[model samples]
Target: MFTSMTVINILLSLVFLYFLGKYLLNMYFEGINRPEQWAGKLKQGKITRELQKAQRQYGDKSRFFLFWLQIERIKKEQIQGTFAELGVYKGDSARILHLMEPTRKIHLFDTFEGFIVADLAKEKGEAASYTPTNFSDTSVDEVKRFLGNSDTFVFYKGHFPESAQSLDTEKYAFVNIDVDLYNPTKAGLEYFYPRLSPGGVIIIHDYSYKWEGLVKAVDEFVRGIPENLVLSPDTDGSVLIIKNSVHT
Candidate 1:
């Protein structure tokens, strides 16, 4: 039983309170997060275009921050090892890894024929859900052409582990595991983890709960291992495991 003026006043008051609360909350978080500080830095009195491009490409500050941080760390530590990608379907990510650290040899491993019978068998669901159809579109020549350089490139165009036989003694500073099925994921982890250089990192895509097979593979692989799984909070659901020990 309120007058029209009273109802309007109450509504305005609530709106004001909402804005005030929002401002206070923003201030509180700003103090702790200091996003402004992390977002920009003085590099010859100008913002770095590389950092800006990374932020725009990722569409998330936190994600770009983590990725940039890792690159900087690897460079600073001078982690000596090659770069590798276990699932080089179209060579998109492989291209980026090569550009990221061009001096390091980048190994591309894949069947280029999609999932094998063994990889499909490791999958729990229907074969249709994890079909091995589309990946056959790519080839080693296509990937090499895309990169436009073969000096630092080494393509393992066959089933993994067997394809990886040539790299038995190879050590990697960065390894990207994008093979969707359980078997390849498991095999990639088993092979890469032991050879990861100290301070190097292995980024496993699809570590999020969405990919149950990948989650299971990563979980089982790292069960009793001493290495820590640092999951990214980004939308891509990537988890990075850093090789901290200098020994092995």
Candidate 2:
């Protein structure tokens, strides 16, 4: 039943797939076998196996590396407080954050179910295209399992700010705010910045033009704060806030 052209087309498709598969395999093997492109010797490089694991787990190598570097500085400076993540998606960054500093407890907050309808209503740019179900792929249980629910991991499965109501008195050394919309991004700043300890670090992700709402929220928030905005080169871009030292 196969026509001459159809058979030729099938053979061509198979050849293309075979070469494509081989190329991907070669790329992965080459990456694994080579030295990490970011750091040097483990001692001076500060490159642990965990960082390598995080590199593999995280979507943006620079962002994960930025987290690792900032946390190390936090420790060296003896910033004293717990950690918090305003928006956790499948616990990828949260797991790396926890692993980087296992002693510090990490409070994870998210709707887990996904974007709230209200939050998306006024959004613009890349966020306007999203639906309420866009980020609802995984659940709290799935993320918890991924994070191993270790003693240092705490889960708050609901809308943030609302989820953080009981923790008003809590102080944080590190806060990662990754909610993609404007309202939550603004709310995260209002709540976490005041609670952030002196010398604490906060990172708000999605600061690029692709997510105009997030960018606008961060821009407005940073304008009011004493800390200067430090931008990262991560794929989605992230804005960093390092609380001023007590002496400053």
Candidate 3:
């Protein structure tokens, strides 16, 4: 409707105004409020520091940040049941759970070696292709050493879901799945979900990066049990599912 020069000038002015507003908004947010500073610290340094502190204070052999957090939450809620961990690589997480909730019985499941062909197959879509031949470098022994003669904890050696099925426990307040494969994750869920006490918590490790299978399994599991289950924001690929009520 206007002359070409006028239109061009208006457009340039609008762009300038937009940039100016953006700059002012950014500056305002960056200054006294320092919201971005808090966010930056949370994203860059704080989370890592917290996780590291948890690991160090809890003992590196059997402690991971996500698992420890789950234990704290479970105990705070006063949930009633035993605790179990499937796919205990070196038993660090299980050991931490044992220490955190000393009154509760803790079950540790693992092959004590590295991944089996079946584990690799389910995780990587290729059986035996990615199996680790040497477990000498792994952390299983460290977990054992850390727990050294704990009476409240029991270790079950073998493939999971099967080992879990052998567990006679009728109820569990917490279950941690860290097998890193789809089948084990699925199997663990199937085995433990029914045993979970009302208001219990289930934690799946490696649910994010490097373990898409865990995420998929968790997603599908949550879909099937949407009423009482809630997933946590991803933590070291761990996904937490809290059962707020009984499924009936």
Candidate No. with top lDDT: 2
* Colliding residue pairs in candidate 2: none
RMSD of 3: 13.7
Residue 157 CA displacement from its true place in model 3, Å? 0.5
Model 1: per-residue Cα lDDT over 1-248, one tens digit each:
99999999999999999989866775554445434434454334444554344344433345445555666578778988888889999886676565456677888899988888767765653333766675878888888788886589888988888899877999888888988777888889999999998889998876765567788889998885788789887666789999877564
The TM-score measured for candidate 1 stands at 0.74
On residues 146-238, what C-alpha lDDT tens digit does candidate 2 reach at each position?
A: 888488988898987799888889999999999999999999999999998899999998888899888888889888988899988877888
For model 3, how does the per-residue alpha-carbon lDDT over 1-248 read when each residue is reduced to its tens digit?
Answer: 79999999999999999989866765553344323433464567654453434344442222243455566667778888888888777665665666556778888887787767656665643222455663525555577787777677777877776766666666989888877667778888888887888778787766555666766777787788864444444445456677767456
Model 1 bad stretches (over 4 Å):
1-66, 125-128, 246-248
Please report how far candidate 3 places residue 215 from its true position, in Å: 2.0
Best of the two (2, 3) by TM-score: 2
Q: Candidate 2: where are CA atoms >4 Å away?
A: 1-50
Q: Model 1 scores what on Cα lDDT?
A: 0.75
Name the lDDT value of residue 213 in candidate 2: 86
How do the predictions measure up, each by TM-score?
Answer: 0.74, 0.83, 0.65
Q: Please state every model's RMSD to the true fold in angstroms.
A: 9.0, 4.3, 13.7
The Cα error of candidate 2 at residue 228, in Å, is 1.1
Error of 1 at 112 (Å): 1.4
